[model samples]
Target: MKQKSENQKAFPRFLGILVVASLIGGVLGGLSGVAGYFWEDHTAFGAAFAHLLGAASPWAMAACAAVLLGLGLYQYRKSDTAFHGWDGEDEDVMQRAEERLSWALLLDSLTVIVSFFFFNAGTAKLPQSSDGNTITLLVIFLVVIALATLLQQKTVDLTKKMNPEKRGSVYDMKFQERWWESCDEAERRQIGQASYKAYVTVSRFCPYCWGVLLLGNMVFHYGILPSAVVLVIWAVLSVSYTREAIRLGRRGQKTE
Candidate 1:
């Protein structure tokens, strides 16, 4: 009886979702039709986006860097403080700080890369551009790189301070490898779990990116390179995960 009741209740939610999907599909189809009609000779809309991002890339990066430094340092200090007393929430504080700082590093790196991209793109027309303007962009790009490196090193050093068990210098070429080797079993397990979660997220998000890229191509003719890059990333992730899983399975069976 409960199963039947649950099935009956599920139909309304299912139908609602179906209706919502249909509405979205209908809207997209209608807009795509209009876009296709206008897309014939006018690619201004598409090319304009890159130009705009390129123009604003430095400012975007500056904002990200500011947050990366300010909030990151605050969190690090909060976690590093010794006054957490009885409950021993220090571990939690450190973990939270580490996670936020890691994200800040990632965000800052992305901004630096984006700024570099725009700088490179803008340089293609350097002959047409004033030397002063070109020099400014170049200087900003260099500063962005230097700032990103500083924030990354600070995050790593503060992380090490909070967790003395952590090892490896941020400047070391084999830092990641050394850090992984230094992790104890529990830390290694946590790292593995986080990696697996990231893998799963990227795997799921790839399809949405594919769909967006397809739409962009249809409307703006950005070509297939973006989609191909996403495919390559997905393929690498899947292959590496599978290879590691198989290797671990084999190792488990060998009574070494």
Candidate 2:
């Protein structure tokens, strides 16, 4: 009989394909937006873009762009370090979590692209701080970062899954084992503490990373959309991803 584990199971495989498609679609759509954004001065399209970002000044876009990018980098570092705590048995769960995250990242990329096209027309003809090329380039940079991080996470997931014993951390196994054995008051407290810390670490950094992502989309959408909107979206996505990680973490708790 064929091994079920070795088989390319439908859901994960399907999700993987969808993720790739979404990323491709978003990149293409974003390019169109860049073209339209720089299409011409005093055109109807330019006027509309100004209306979308909610700021007529291009300098506003520039400022937010810098902030978003800076925050994105910081969040990336934090996320990178957060997962180092998980060990061998937790590897499969983490891999699945990361695979799901990859799909979400791709969807976000596509959303950013679609938002750009939605605001293709009707922004200010003249940018406040920099030229259209500069702003468009910044948007591209955001896309690059999103793509890179997702790829890195996915690769790490695959590597861990492939060599769980060799690369695995002993601490993760001991933590899980101990947590499972004693469900007593002190143990409960330790479990709660570990769960909370893990959740917060993942939840905080993941959303910031995703927030920076949405900010890119917002930039495409509003030209200078409110920072409030960006934060709001960040909160929503963070909650969603957090719920997912918690569910996985709990499952891991049970299995061990």
Candidate 3:
């Protein structure tokens, strides 16, 4: 039997893939949830499309809460990676980045929920003939999403800056002769390890998180179901993400 290495011990092949699958699933489920909201709001007998599109306060609050809850669960489960494996000079930098990213995600999620609740509660307190309140709140929501995106983007960029040698896909590094040549042995090893660790930590699905937020906005805007099957599809996707993480861990060990 083949001996499993440290990487394998920390991130089993099956579990890694499960995380990846969860990333994909999270993205798809978010999209599906958004679509479902739209369908319910705009179908023939559905809730008024304009009300949703305008992001009536209560609904917005609910949507925000859903996102927070889903992503919060994901992060809570995977946040241990900052200390799970790896050690050496660059380890501190890696851990700091991981923690920073986690907090950022948490902040974004919480802010969204709070904002939604505030907007809805205010709307309910004061009676109004026009939907000025709702529209104003939607605009605010858009701005918040944009700002959140920038913050996350900056956080990811910081990680890249701190670890300059480990950007882009493995294929990109391998195919580019000039870039590969520029790397010294130490740099190469650092890059390789960092890249592999990242593959192992599907700890948070940032892309999917954002995608779901966008989907929510779309649902409110379009008010069309688009598709209901996305949920079922993503249920399977979660498993696939987990599998991919695990497979990458296994592959890294083989290379060692």
Best-fitting candidate, measured by TM-score? 1
Best by lDDT: 1
- Tens-digit lDDT track for model 1 on 195-240? 9999999998997798778667766666999999999999999999
By TM-score rank, best first, the candidates go 1, 3, 2
TM-score of model 1 (CA atoms): 0.74
TM-score of 3: 0.33
Ten-residue stretch with the least lDDT total in model 3: 223-232
**Regions more than 4 Å wrong, model 3:** 1-94, 109-130, 168-234, 238-256
RMSD (Cα, Å) of model 2: 18.6
RMSD of each: 5.2, 18.6, 13.9
| Full-model lDDT for every candidate | 0.73, 0.52, 0.57
Tens digits of per-residue lDDT, candidate 3, 158-239, equal: 4455457644432353534544565779867886787556644433444454455546645555432323334444545567
Query: Cα lDDT for residue 190, model 3?
Result: 83
Residue by residue across 1-256, what tens digits does model 2's lDDT show?
A: 3576657566698899789967876785676567546554336765565554544333443444345434443443443443555564666655554544444444434444443432332133335544555466456545644554454445444435543532422235464454355355674677668767765776566545554545455334544354465566667767876787799899999999
Question: Comparing 1 and 2 by TM-score, which wins?
Answer: 1
